[model samples]
Target: MKKVILTALMSCIFQFSNAQNDIRIGGMLAYGTEVENIGIGVNAEFPIIEKLTVSPSFIYYLPKKVSGVSINWFEFNGNANYYFLDEGNINVYGQAGLNYTNVRLSYDGAYSGFLSSAASDGRLGLNLGGGANFQMGGNILPFAELKYVIIDEGQLVLAAGVKFNL
Candidate 1:
């Protein structure tokens, strides 16, 4: 299942490369309580239709000690964003999508344990969020976003980044 999803995502990126009206690539700093850590991410926004865009993002959280366990986390998401105000320097948008998250845990200097087993499982979740885009002169846009992840235990994410139009 993971392989298929990854293949499809890669295909979409290549297929849309030439046809997309606008493409923005950027990096973000993310914080979420589920991982109880800060993460770094890269994202690309591709226009799909009028006032609508598709964004693919990946985030990696550094290993951190939490509750006596060391944890490392990562996530991949594909989101659809609808711009409420598309024709201005400032745009507010709503986004909804799906994400796949993977976590690894270590305890007592060993990786084989209940926490490791549970954390190694892949989780699929829903992502809902909103953000604002501040377009600077030319092709630079700085953005801030907030998103919620609905899974076993819900998580809230806050991210900020710069988008470069291509």
Candidate 2:
């Protein structure tokens, strides 16, 4: 009876330890001069399994143009992140994703030549970064992150967002 009880207790503890899963919704700003120019985005993440998360994001930007003209672009993207070190208040991860981009250019006031020109493209890239989470109250983690990715041109994206553990 003692042996059976010990085995059951160990199994319960192991299962509880493995049940650490969560989802996060947040916003970010991204810049890729050769592509979307500049964009502000919102993103959400869900952990499908241990150490891996699936994220989907959307971004919108208006690029400064010559002669009072500006261009607008929107991007839809998804990524998979693998956490290499998941411990304490700091975590390290690597990510890869695909982006579907819609590019539009517009002119105002004086420039008549530029009028809502648009282009759409698909891009694939990889990202790597690490972040520290500062626990602010229960279930809320304020984090600072730095990541680099390449979508035809190289980009460095720095972000500060909150993570919600579900």
- Candidates in order, TM-scores: namely 0.79, 0.65
Give the runs in model 2 whose Cα sits over 4 Å from its true position: 1-21, 33-38, 108-137, 145-149
The CA lDDT at 79 in model 1 is: 96
lDDT of 1 at 95: 93
Model 1 C-alpha lDDT versus the unseen true structure: 0.86
- Superposed by TM-score, candidate 1 places the C-alpha of residue 89 at a distance from the truth, in angstroms, of 2.5
Q: lDDT per prediction?
A: 0.86, 0.64
- Tell me the lDDT of model 2 at 21: 50
Where is the poorest 10-residue window by lDDT in model 1? 109-118
Question: Candidate 1 regions off by >4 Å?
Answer: 1-19, 108-119
Q: Provide the lowest-lDDT 10-residue window in model 2.
A: 109-118
